[model samples]
Target: MAVATGLKQEQVVAAAASDNALERLHALLTEDLRQVNALIISRMESPVPLIPQLAGYLIASGGKRLRPLLTLAAARLFGYQGDAHLLIATAVEFIHTATLLHDDVVDESDLRRGRESANSVWGNQASVLVGDFLFSRSFELMVETHSLEVLRILSRASAVIAEGEVLQLITSNDTATVEADYLRVIEGKTAELFAAACEVGAVIAGCDKQACAAMRDYGMALGMAFQIVDDVLDYSAVQAQLGKTVGDDFRAGKITMPILIAIAKGNEEERAFWNRTLERQEQEEGDLDHAIALLRQHDALDGAMDRAREWGERAIAALEHAPESVLKQALADVIAFCIERDY
Candidate 1:
């Protein structure tokens, strides 16, 4: 169950304290999310038992299951009561898992959720193959949904995700990657799937075009906030909570928000460090600290987080057409939590 992630009611309330109605909505959304998670696990395919080893390893790692939750919650908000929601929810989870499998490979990440990553435990080859398996499996499940419109949205989202991965790869280590470029990459990589999740839910509910569009906009804004926060975490979060070292992005040659902002504002010495560290991928013993200090000195991390909050507020505003209900309020709360949560 999605609830198996051990999301506490108190945590949700604390996460949503700024808005009372959202607390109630989060409670219901959590329950629906549990059902969606079960569906995802049950539908995941592993013809060879060994294949299941890595696939199950990652699937059972206790992610927040936000993507699937968004799908079910959006459908529920529109009064959908069909099993199609379950199928589509699983599809979303599969898509998300597939991305993670590939991401760990690309990032060479050793840890996730405080545990060894699948690539670390099972090997990169297995991780890549299992990731391919999940991607194909997601498409197969999408085909089973039988809604051409749903299929179209998911297919296009999948394509965009791949393109985003490629874009990030090309832009990696390039200090010239500005805010607009970073935004485009995250929108395609992260927000497109989110937008698709909400869109599919609205489609399943037969929602009007205006409401559907609203949900899409909400998802896009939420995802933008989500990615920005993730970038911030790379700089601000502790290793225990971040599940990685503070300067992991710089080590990986990825020019994230904090680094980009820092580069733009850095002086001659700081710019030289960035060039050698990122451009040359040569990190001396103290380079990480230097990068972190630069980010803090310029307030890039906090600035990016402020931008995330702004996007979260815009997301709440996009929900104006949504009915005044606890669920609507909770959707807004999730966006706020995305911006504020430590881990």
Candidate 2:
């Protein structure tokens, strides 16, 4: 089910995007990630058995756990020498998992991380309530850290993520959605948590404001790059590796950057097609192919990747402000994984 829109995963990851970045990072952070996993499992437990069952369903499903890894890696970069990084990393993961539950409910999505989404299995109400439980559990972890700053950073990120989700809801199915609007939505939804994840790592390490800012910048840039690449992959990647089926965005009428660029650059006939498929919700057979054709004709997906690359470069540059360490270099490698994964 790879979108045969004429762009293959091989074509997309041809040059800049390297899979080794994640592998290297994983190897570098193996022990710390193991601890984070144990913390995640232990914290997911609740008196109510359903909570752990539903949470465990998705938790056991393989996600790379990249955000928590970022937290641990950032803390390690600053020579943090305590167990707090482990706790904070687990908390960051809980926040992310909560968002995923809510997002699947919002999207009415049946699939997640290449399997049945939690919402699909447990019903939306269960999925949402469990998500809330995870969020609450995360705050408990934050309280255990006893750092007001860490709590403040994560709480703000949670609020921002809510705003982003709300904004995306408002804009969904609107072909008129603009690039600025799309970027803003992703900033709130994707990048804010990433920034917080890395920032909290630095905070726990007692890094100064400058080092904290550097980690934030790195995370933000990587998040932006990661999201844009994901959007492109919706139309250009192997469906097996895409975490969701191809053309899910288009079918949902959720206007993404590729669609926006095409709308801006396409001719009148092409515009009508977008309006019918997206705005009018009048999709017909062959629409995915046609959408892909328009995107390819306009080179919109390629253009979107270029923007992702620019952000990746910024992510790499942000690392320079932090003191050099193997962890820092691993974070840099994450930038490559963000940008160049299956184009």
| Candidate 2 clash pair list | 17-340
lDDT (10s digit) by residue, model 1, range 1-343:
1221224555445545544333445466655666766766666646687676788888888777788778877887777767787788888888888899899998899987778999999889988988888888778877887888889989999999999999999888887788888888999999999999998999988998899899999999999999989888877756546455666687888887888889988888888888898988988998887788888899998888888888888898888888664566678768877887777
Candidate 1 lDDT at 218 equals 93
RMSD of 2: 7.7
Best by lDDT: 2
Error of 2 at 40 (Å): 0.7
Can you give the TM-score per candidate against the true fold?
A: 0.90, 0.92
Residue-pair clashes per candidate, as listed? 1, 1
TM-score of 1: 0.90
Model 1 pairs in collision: 2-34
